[model samples]
Target: MSSKQGGKAKPLNQPKADKKEYDEIDKANIQKKKDEEKMLKELKAKAQQKGAFGGSGLKKSGKK
Candidate 1:
């Protein structure tokens, strides 16, 4: 009978997450992520030092 009821119903609010508790697994995972990030940085530096990957892969001849 009400206008609100005739319209779409509102969604229920989601429950908030509780405080995070870091256990041994969490600590190990975090360490692994850090190691991966460090390795990525090193690899990026090496790539930059080496210059662009293999250039444009085409040789331009001066002869027409």
Candidate 2:
């Protein structure tokens, strides 16, 4: 029942290491995510326009 065995008393004075440099990869991943999100949004809009989920049923009202 010792406190040492219970994992206590670690001060928050440890120096944290810097993140690894993967800027190019990170940028590409972020761009990919943005593109994916944009595509999904567009698809959702298209599906809604087609009344895929019985949205407003106004998709065929033809106001455009």
Candidate 2 residue pairs in clash (backbone atoms < 3 Å)? none
Query: For residues 2-63, what per-residue lDDT tens digits would candidate 2 score against the true structure?
Result: 54555576778978899877788898998999999999999998887776465564446558
lDDT of 1: 0.91
Q: Could you tell me how far off, in angstroms, the CA of residue 20 lies in candidate 2 after the best superposition? A: 11
- Per-residue lDDT tens digits for candidate 1, residues 1-64, read 6555666888999999999989999999999999999999999999999886887767789998
lDDT of 1 at 56: 73
- Residue pairs with colliding backbones in model 1 are none
**Top model number, lDDT:** 1
Cand. 2 TM to true fold: 0.47
**TM-scores of the models, in the order given:** 0.58, 0.47
- What C-alpha root-mean-square deviation, in Å, does candidate 1 show against the real structure? 3.8
Alpha carbon lDDT at 28, candidate 1: 100
